[model samples]
Target: MQALKHFRIDFVITAAVLVVAFLYDSWAGVGLTAILIVVEIVFSFDNAAVNAKYLDRLNHFWQTMFLTVGVIVAVFGMRLVFPFVIVCLSGSISPWSALNLALEKGDPHTPGTYGYILTEAHPAIAAFGGMFLLLLFLDFMFDEDREISWLTWIEKPLKKLGKLDVLSVIIAGIFLLVASETLVHETHVHTAVQMRSIVLFSGLLGIILYLAVSGLSTMMEEREAAKDHEFEEADAHSSTGQKVLLAGKAAFSMFIFLEVLDATFSFDGVIGAFAITPDPIIIMLGLGVGAMYVRSMTIFLVRNGTLAEYRFLENGAHWAIGALAVMLVISIRYDLGEFVIGGVGIAFILAAWASSILANKRDAVAEGATDSTEQGANV
Candidate 1:
């Protein structure tokens, strides 16, 4: 009952969206919308786990902003408006034309259709999102401060390599160069040179954006830590309002980082949603509901201290993110169906959960043995 309360808002929102979907197109609309909601949730389950790590740092106020303002950005902003922007930019058409194209609901098979235009833009989208996610995985793998190692062999060496400055950047740059040259050949939409240029430039932008957000977030966190240290050293009791203000300021960069991270995660889902149905309205309704549930899950995990309880859960999520990054890049050349993409992440998460349970049992048995041995010695 307590756990169910966390999802009360999600339940209400999902019911309302489903009703709207049903009214819009009868049974067919409801069916497609249901599929989309499932699709979005499956594809982004790992995302919820990753989100909880950062969302937990935020105070109640900013967390509310994540649900409210963030939902608008996730739903309409990414699902509806972002696609229009992509169509306009990729098709070299005006916003009004793009709007018309979307409303027309033309066949995806036909060129110049909105779906076709978005599909045409997939390479650039994949490249940009892939690079950003790749860097995220690289940074996590290489972090020396990470005390827990899910895959000891891989993580330990990576942590040592992290001591080298800009190592993640160097590796990511090489990946972009190789992917741009090789993957661009797979698509003949533009000449090889043109396609390569698009992939390279877009991938570079992803890397730059990641660097900027991460650097700013680090700076803010360090500054906040320094202030806290001074307060502690001086034994000063800060006012509640002042502490709240400081927390909000410190969390601002994290908020921005989470938004960008969400955007990258959405790129694949938005594009893949077309494969299910090309109606932007239905897409928004379904994916929007799924996004809300993900937010609810994030907050639930934070409130329950799920990350601490299941120690390997976060590690599993990062592994899934790494796999997703590779898959996005590979998808530039081949269409690995949504099933494969979603399944890999799910598998990692389940495995991590199982491992955590086993570790707990082992500790319990060891502690029992020690206690029995001490009793025997006393006897």
Candidate 2:
């Protein structure tokens, strides 16, 4: 009963969101979205485990920021912005025109059916996928923390660069800008001028989001401090509140960071999804819902301690991340469709998770047998 009460809010929120989505659409779109949610949730099991390690360090206000702002961006921002940038770089239309199209029709998936829409999809998409894939490969191969990761040498030297908070935000902005512009020119889809403007605008968006999260965090801290001073000595509180506040903030930042990570993962995912259906609405619906489920599941894992108990869960998630990164890179250079990406990525995690479960069972059985033998010998 007590546990239920603690999680009642979470349950209610989830239920409400589902109800609303269901009410909004009942046919192909909603069904597709549901499937996406499930797929995303399953594939992202490891992500949640990894996320908890950071979320456990944040404060509450940030936690709230994570659930709200983080969710919105994860569901809409990336899904919408990425494809638009692709359009802009292709020079199919101006940035303003692309935005108008998406708003008027809600994310056109294919160039042909986009109402004779001026689109720059062709080579830019290929280039975007390629760059995304390259990044994925480097991340998977060089990421230095997967139970003895590959790039510890660089991590320490990089740590000396100072204020990772600021640096990470800057890097994210730069990536968005470069990704938008580079894809446009390399794909030969758009003019340099158009691509440049798109990159600049997208970079600005990144900067604004970073500032919003950070500024909100600072304000929250100030408010918390004032609250602390108001209490008398006998009625004083322990630092648990402060700790939770910190954990929430860290969690929020980590949540956004993970979303960026998720976006990187989605580069291939979205590309592959198009193979299934060219409808932008369906694609967004599917991928958006999937991201949502993954995000929720991540929160569940942190709260449940499943990862900590399993021990091998983190390894599995990192392995999944690494694999997805590689897969994205490969897709960039080749045409490894959705089935391959989804199948291979999900299979790796499932195999790893199943292996961990079996190992745990074996260990438990061995311990039980040993204890029984000891009891008999003592007897």
Candidate 3:
């Protein structure tokens, strides 16, 4: 009951959204909307888990901003408006015409269908999103302070190599080059020397965007942490004020990362939604509803301290990100069933959870043994 109290508003709003969705369309429309919601939630579970780590660091104001302002970007900016923008860019159509294409319900049979436009445009999307996600994975995996390792043999060495700030960029660039050259869709007819130029350039753009935001934010945060404050109790309040300012800066930076991260996660769900139906309104309703739930779930994780308890859950989510990154690049040239994409993530999640339980049990046994040995020595 206590737990449910905190989420009463989320529950009410979610229920209201579903009710409105049902009322907005025919039975088939309602059914499609529900499916879209479920699909988004499943695909977005890792995204929620990853988001909670950053959101937890923020103060209340930033947290509120994430829920209110950030949700709009997730729901409308990415889920609704972004795809049309992608079509316009990829298909060279006007914004209005691109929107109409999205609304027309894509025809799989026609070679020049909206579905075809979106599908054809995927290489660029994959290049951009893949690099962003790969960098995200590398950053986490290479953290020197990270103690637990899901894949120690590989992760341990990566952590050591993290001494160089640019290693992740180097590795990611290599990946971009190899994937660009080898995995390109056969339809592209660029001169042999320039085959992967566009894709590679798009990936470079992803890296620059990531570094621009993440680097600036990190610099501000480190500067704040290095400031000297009076150790006397008389100055404690002033020191606390400075800490708040630092937190605010960091939170602002995190807000940017969170929005970009959410946008990357949406690429799969948005593209996949077209597979089910091309009705833009349905895509909006379904993905928007799911985004709401993910927000609620993120809050729930923070309030409950779920990540602190799970131990290896964040690691699993990072691994999932890595897997998804590779899969996106592969999906550019080949067809990957939606089930396969979703299933790979789900498997990692389950494995991490079970491992957490075992780790807890081992710690319990070790503690019990220590206590028993001390008692015997005292006796």
Model 3 bad stretches (over 4 Å): 1-7, 188-195, 227-246
Leading candidate by TM-score: 1
The per-prediction CA RMSD against the true structure, in angstroms, equals: 2.8, 7.9, 3.0
Off by over 4 Å in 2: 1-26, 42-46, 59-64, 99-253, 373-379
Checking candidate 3 for backbone clashes, the offending pairs are none
Question: What residue pairs clash in candidate 1, if any at all?
Answer: none
Q: What is the TM-score of each candidate against the true structure?
A: 0.95, 0.60, 0.91
For residues 1-56, write the lDDT of model 2, one tens digit per residue.
Answer: 75566556655655655565567555555566566556665655555555655565
Tell me the tens digit of each residue's lDDT in model 3 across 1-379.
9668876876787677677767767677778888988888887888888999888877777878888888888999998788878778777889888867766776733555676777667777888898999999999988999988876778899899889989999999999989988887455334444536768888888888888878977876666555533332356576565434336566688788888988988888888887887677888888898898888788778768899898988888899899988998888678796778888987887788888889989999999999999999999
Residue 373 displacement (Å), model 2: 4.9
Give per-residue lDDT, candidate 2, residue 16.
59
| Residue-wise C-alpha lDDT for candidate 1, range 186-296, written one tens digit per residue | 443587788889999999999999999999988998888787776655654553333423365678998899999998999999989999998888988999999888877
Local error of candidate 2 at residue 178 (angstroms): 19
lDDT of each: 0.88, 0.53, 0.81
Task: Point out the higher-scoring one by TM-score: 1 or 3.
Answer: 1
Rank list by TM-score? 1, 3, 2
